[model samples]
Target: MQAPELVERMLRGDRRAVARTISLVENAAPQLREIMAGLAPHTGRARIVGLTGSPGVGKSTSTNALVKALRARDESVAVLAVDPSSPFSGGALLGDRVRMQEHATDGGVFIRSMASRGHLGGLSWATPHALRVLDAAGFGVILVETVGVGQAEVDIARHADTTVVLCAPGMGDSVQAAKAGVLEIADIFVVNKADREGARVTARELRQMVGQVEHGPGEWKPPIVSTVAAKGEGIDELLGRLDEHHAHLTATGEADRRRFARAREEIEAIVMSTLRARLGDVHGHAALDKLADAVATGHGDPYSAADTLLAALDT
Candidate 1:
């Protein structure tokens, strides 16, 4: 079907159109550039918050809790939970949809699971397209949740208007948070299971870490919140903070700056993905396969392989 036709249907709030648009974006359709241009005008208006943590730190649970709280405030929320890409099949794990069962019947809440699909470091090339559909469809809040693995945690803050990093007791992630790159990206630190034995200790370490950072005058201090997401404990307080942060951004003229950064990152993701698609297998299969073999054999330099891809651009 034509891009305009699909876009018109999506503007009319057709569920099928919305799903179809998202599918096209996910697959990086050749016509996607045309589709996005049409949808651009309908974008913005959704508060995109990124929730991220290690796989077991209850990122999804907290996300569900936040969505519920937002709905209670009469806000329509869209949750896009992200999963890792499959190495062999390149498909998303899609566990978030199955886990967010309670919101299945709620029309006000739209939930979707996305995958990096080997688009590393929180790569969300199709996110702008998806968010555009939701924004046009009338969602007031958009939550992008990522499984905080590797250096991808930093990427979340880049996408979100306000980022909340989730950490729980017994995760041995205190220093790891400082090193995992989560600490730098978080505007707020959450000790997810406040009732746990070492919640306070975890909070203290985080607080100290935050204190050590030198900031310009009037910098917003990141607050450490404690919550038990399963029973909805502390959910209200967390939502309150989200509201406060959003308000601060708008009041201080920082919203424009934050949106600028988010836009750039989103555009970079799209451009990079599109370029990669246009040039399939950037590193020839043989070179990449051999590079993997070389790493295994400790004979070939991975850096040379990277240099090779750049050099190929000149060829």
Candidate 2:
């Protein structure tokens, strides 16, 4: 279908159109500009939530449980499960469709697995665009589940309105979270596998850590909720906390600020990507190569090389 038709279908909540549009985004198809333009006016309606944590933390299971809760509330949800990339084909290593089979047939739920494509941040570069498509497709809530992230891979905070960090008991994840600076990025900390032996200790550690942060009067403090996600335990409390955080964001005007920042970053990323593409052009590439050769031989400096490349790109 044409971009206009696709956008219309997507806005009308057509699942096929939503999938096709996201595919276009993932592949960086030429139709994106027109499609994004058409979809832009319909976005900003969905509530975006991001889930990230270490491996074996039940992130997927927690996400599955969350989807069930949201569906019970009669809300439509889209799950963007980002998986590690396959080295050979750059495809998503894990198929979320298999893990989330219960929701596969639910019209109110749309689940897609996207490869991170070697992005060190644990999220695909196309994530923002894919989110826009889902939001415009009329999903009430969008869940972004990142690949198992390590220290410095907490980019999910930049993309979502609410960020949930999950940790399982007995994994030393609580300490790892502190060391990784994830403590600062998390709006909600979950101790999944709460039925495990060390679950209470893990939750206590997170609470103590959170309490150490000095928040002024109305500042939101991250809460530690324990859950056995595999059995859908404590999911209700998790949902309640999500609601409370959303309300806090609205009451404090932080929601608008976050959305503005998200938009600014999205625009900047697009510009950077476009510039990189331009710099890969024939003239720009040749100019850069010549500069590199000169710099290597000590005939040209690195600064001058960059200047020449910029000039070539401008031309």
Best by TM-score: 2
Worst 10 residues of 2 by lDDT: 116-125
Clashing pairs in 2: none
lDDT of each: 0.76, 0.84
lDDT by residue (tens digit), candidate 1, 1-315: 899998788777676677677777666677777877877887777788888887688888898889888888889888876554342442433565475567777777877766545545234766666766778766789898876566556666766788898888988997677886776788888889888899989989989999888866777778888999988999998888888888888888887898787788778877776666544556557766766787779886788866766676556
lDDT of 1: 0.76
Best-matching candidate per lDDT: 2
- Which residue segments of model 2 deviate by more than 4 Å? 84-94, 118-125, 150-153, 282-301
**What tens-digit string does per-residue lDDT give for candidate 2 at 204-290?**
999989998898989999989989999999999999999999999999999899989888878887787776777787364567788
- TM-score of candidate 1 versus the correct structure, residues matched by position: 0.83
Give me the displacement of residue 2 in model 1, in angstroms: 3.6
Query: lDDT score, residue 65, model 1?
Result: 89
Clash pairs of candidate 1?
none
